[model samples]
Target: MLIKRVPSAEAPLDLLLEADPSIDTIKRYLESSICHVATIEGETVGAHVIQPIGDGVYELMNIAVAPAYQGKGIGTKLLEHAVNMSRKLGAQRLELGTGTFGYQLAFYQRAGFRVISVERDHFLTHYDEPIYENGIQHKDRLLLALEF
Candidate 1:
């Protein structure tokens, strides 16, 4: 698999939507974010988006792997690449928002990110549709950060 930076316009929207459900939100961030794609045999299989939020901080806007390629460490590779890229770009820290509970929360924790705060009712207020996992609705957003 190969992971490399690509123009935001060239990012795989379908794959990205696997993580972020709102197309409007994705497009809003994509306008200023740097996108990276993971491909194998010329087929795009995973992707991540990172945006600078000023003061040497960056936000991991989205990360996703194709369903067929899930559980194969593709997401991990993409995340690691994002971290490395942020370091190279002089980022003081990397931050992201995710559901308060889920595999995704644990995934970032395993990668050294720690919970910073919680945005109550973030999903409820921001997203038009309710987000669910394991049959439970996601109502809060946990802000996590990895300090450089």
Candidate 2:
């Protein structure tokens, strides 16, 4: 498998949806962003999108791995690649927001992201449909940051 920046993000829209459920939300972050994809034999298995916020800090806008490929280190590879890419672009830190509780929170924490703040009722205010995982509704967004 190989990981590289994708010229067009159109192809992995489906894969990206696997992580962020809303197309509107995806559009907000995807525009003018850098997109990277992991492919195995030319088939896309995962994708990560990044957008520069300011002051050498970038936002990890979106990252998604095919459901079948989750927990198999593909996401990890994508994240590691994202970090390297960030540093190459002279980034001092990377920021991302995720649910208050989920595998995603654990994953980012493991990757060195620390909780910087929380946006209360973010999902409730933004998403039309409620997002639930492990039978628990996600209402807030935990803003995580990793300073390099």
Candidate 3:
């Protein structure tokens, strides 16, 4: 697998959005942000967006791998790239939000993230439609951070 930065506007965004729809708005807002896609055997399988939030802080906007590719460490490699890229860019901390509970939370925890804050009822109130994954709907957002 290879992770590559894709600068074209038409670069398989549907896959990314399918992983996390909230990112569509973020992608629209951050014009100069960097986006990466992971490919295996010439197929786009995963993607993540990184946006600079000023004050030496960067946000991990979206991190997702294809359903069939989850648990195979593709997300981990992308995360490792994000961490190193942020550090190289002089970021003091990296922040992201995820469902209050689930495999994603544990994935970040395993990747050295720590809970920093929580927005109660964020997912339930912020989104117009319910966000569901594998028969589970996310009701809240938990903010996590890792300082480098």
Q: Find the candidate with the highest lDDT and give its number.
A: 1
Indicate the TM-score of model 1: 0.99
**After superposition, which runs of candidate 1 have C-alpha atoms over 4 Å from their true positions?**
none
* Residue-wise C-alpha lDDT for candidate 3, range 46-122, written one tens digit per residue: 88878898899999988778888987988899999999888988999999989877788999999889999889888
Off by over 4 Å in 3: 22-26, 133-136
Q: Against the true structure, what is each candidate's TM-score? A: 0.99, 0.96, 0.89
Better of 2 and 3 by lDDT: 2
If ranked by TM-score, best first, what sequence of candidates would result? 1, 2, 3
Q: Report the C-alpha lDDT of model 2 over 40-128, residue by residue, as the tens digit.
A: 89888999998899989999988899988888999999999999898999899999999999789999999999999999999999999
* Ten contiguous residues minimizing lDDT sum, candidate 3: 22-31
Name the lDDT of candidate 3: 0.83
Clash count list over all predictions: 0, 0, 0
Task: Give the Cα RMSD of candidate 1.
Answer: 0.5
Task: Name the TM-score of candidate 3.
Answer: 0.89
